[model samples]
Target: MLFDTHVHLNARQFFEDRDAVIQRAFDAGVSYMVVVGFDRETIPLAIEIAEQNETIYAAVGWHPVDAVDMTAEDLDWVEELAAHPKVVAIGEMGLDYHWDKSPKAIQKEVFRKQIRLAKKVNMPITIHNREATSDIIEILQQEDAKEVGGIMHCYNDAVDYVQACLDMNFYISLGGPVTFKNATMPKEVAASVPLDRLLVETDAPFLAPHPNRGKRNEPAYVKLVAEKIAELREMAFEEISEITTENAFTLFGIKRS
Candidate 1:
């Protein structure tokens, strides 16, 4: 069985056939999935989806891109939502300089606030860093993020950054980008991250793996990611499946039956 550690099933892209897509994931050997919300609007949707499906779980937090419009009330709502039983972590939150959707200062403030909330709630975090590695790391360190632990989702940093996260007890999650021929950094991280600290995700509705590149991604395609990790680490498919699934369980505190 496989655990898709990071996915966005609540996104509008899956609105039409969300049920069918989830069923397909189950049929394809995906035993569990964590649906992450990037903004206030999607947080409840993620909780609702998780409530409806036993195999699904939720992660509630604001994304860096949405930080610009966030108000104090919005932060309160996020904190309340993080208390939900199905919510396993605080995030899909961090820094993103790739898009100018939000001001950098606001993004940094929101990221730091969410990290503090995660610590307050005693929940792990799911981080997203894009071209803002240095700032992200600095804030994470300043906020003392290691207390709760977390996963670096869709990791795109160098070995040093990866090591910093590991030192902080965060799992390194590799997604479709790791399979891209031109993705040298992800490939290197995939090869070097200890098996126990490694996790795999599809980041569905985005970053589809090599063969399925440029297409809409889903949890069903996570197997392709596992295969890529298996290839990179020179391990068997079964081994990759076992170790990564276990890593997901450990990070999310989900017990496999």
Candidate 2:
């Protein structure tokens, strides 16, 4: 069994066959999946998907890009929703300097707020750092995020930072980028990061692995990611699946049959 720890099931690309896509995921051995809500519209939809599917779960929060528009009431609302049985974590939220859609100050404020929210709720967080590793690390340290450590979703950063992220008690997750033939950093991270702390995700409707690159990704293709990691580590495919699934359960406090 495998756990696709991150996916955007609320995206429109899966609109035509969302249920079919989910069935394919289960058939492909994805025993559990975390459907992440990155913005306003997708948040409710993510929870809705989780509500209807036994294997699916929801992680809700405002993306950094939408930080400026997010409100205190919104944070309160998210905290309230966090109590839902299907809600696992409090993010897909972190700094995104790449797009610069929101001011750095607002992004930091929102990120810190969500982190604190997760702490208050005693839930782990799913971080989304894009070209903001330094600040992200600094903030995690400053905020003392180790209280309820979470995942570094789709991690693609300097190898040295892996230790730092782990030090802060976070697991490193690799998505479709790990399966990219030419993706050097992800490959290196996969080979070096502790197997016990590693996780796999497709970030579905986004970064599909090698052969399906540039096409819509889904949880079903997460096997490709597991296979690639197994190859990189020279370990058995099933071993990687079991370890990563355990890592997902540990981080999210989930129990699966």
TM-score for every candidate vs. truth?
0.98, 0.98
- lDDT (Cα) of model 1: 0.90
Q: Mind giving the per-residue lDDT tens digits that candidate 2 earns over 64-126?
A: 988998998889989998999999999989999988679999999999999999999999999
For lDDT, the strongest prediction is 2
lDDT of each: 0.90, 0.93
Mark the 10 consecutive residues where model 2 has the least summed lDDT: 248-257
Q: Which residue pairs in candidate 2 collide?
A: none
Highest-TM-score candidate: 2
TM-score of 1: 0.98
Clashes of 2: 0
